[model samples]
Target: MREFKTENIEVAYADNTIIKNLSIKIPIGKITTIIGPNGCGKSTLLKAIGRIMKTKNGAIYLDGKNIYELSSKDFARQLAILPQSPIAPEGLTARELVSYGRYAHQKGFGKPSEKDKEIVKWALEVTNLSELSEISVDNMSGGQRQRVWIAMALAQQTDMILLDEPTTYLDVAYQLEVLELLENLNKEHGCTIVMVLHDINMASRYADYLIALKNGNIVGTGTPKEVITKEMLREVYHIEADIMIEERTKKPTCISYRLNNRKIAVEAGIKKGIKVVG
Candidate 1:
């Protein structure tokens, strides 16, 4: 297992800084979900950690060495990132897309070796896409397409996988299917999984650890039982939420929530230069 951590990092887009002085240590071999309201810099943090974007300051370390010091192929061999809504080339079959993951392991000309082919086949089997390997990605359902993308990542044979909102547009059933597959990946193969999720209940149900962010800062980080709370919802989302512990999985669940009018009114009043007494 490898260690991944960021040290006091800052990320910016031109003049606007999105994340400031952030530090995080991703627990190895676990499913970690980053949650917060929109525009909290969750995706920005993921991009930096995945090396898809650069940080303006500080260092990201992989197993004690700075990530910038590693070559692209070397880095890709260790971790794979599946961006949200990845688009495949038209007419590309599931197997064809998965074959691309062998790029880093290949030498010049990047021909698929027998070992690469075998690994790709195994990835398809594990993802339950072996039969659909010949189907064009564009012709598949949303869940199938997502699995194809995941199979591509799996073919990389990385110890860690980073995903951004893997269930964004899927229907509820497909959402559960994807999350269950990820759970199996963690439990069976021991892959470290990190992703950003919009649904608090889904995140709570699937995640072994949760990192909650608000306005570019980490507001809470812990297990679901510790992080998913009424106070956390109030602080991070400005909502009053009812929390419960699921009996089957023993995970925290957010059953109901509504906007906190008093908090909203106070902030609005303060912004308008009114003396508000609570």
Candidate 2:
């Protein structure tokens, strides 16, 4: 597993800086999540960690060595990234797409080795895509296609995997399935996982470490129990809520209260006399 460290990292698009002097460490063999509102640089930070974005400042280190110094093949061999949105090639079977992950491991002038095939098999099996291996990706449902993409990343056999909003198009059941698969990967194979998650409750349930960001800055970093507080929800999400401890698991559960009509009217910039209801 790889331990990732970012120091004074910054990214800008035109005049707006999406990430500013952000430094964070992703602990090895654990699921670390980046949580924030839209356009708060969480995805940018993921791209930087994955080396998909070129940064003008700071450095990202993997296993105590500078990741930028690694060659493309060597880097791909050690790290695999699943971007926020990945499009599948038309008419490509799931197995064929997963086989592309072996590109980094294949030697020049040779076919895929036995070990490569084994890795591909295990990846497909782990993701429960073995049955659909021969199916074309274009015909699959959104959740199935997402699993295929994740299978490709797993087929790479890298110790560190970076995923940006992996559950974007998935239903609730599929979302839990993906998260459980990731948890299994971390627990069974000791893979290091770093992901940008939009759902705070899911992030709290799945991630071992949480990093909250706002306006290109880190607002908090700690375990879910330590970092997810009533104040944090209000500060990061601009919502008022009460935090309670779940009886069974003892995790923090946030309960948001609906604002009264009077407060809602003022917040919505509507006249007091206007009555609106479903």
Worst 10 residues of 1 by lDDT: 261-270
Model 1, 1-278: lDDT tens digits are 47999999999999899999999999999999999999999999999999998999999999998999999999999999999899999999999999999998999896799999999999999999999999999999999999998889999999999999999999999999899999999999999999999999999999999999988999999999989999999888889998888999999888889999887777778889986686
Error of 1 at 268 (Å): 4.4
Whole-model lDDT per candidate: 0.94, 0.85
Global local distance difference test of model 1: 0.94
Model 1 backbone overlap count: 0
Worst ten-residue run, lDDT, model 2? 258-267
lDDT of 2: 0.85
Q: Give stretches of model 2 more than 4 Å off.
A: 257-278
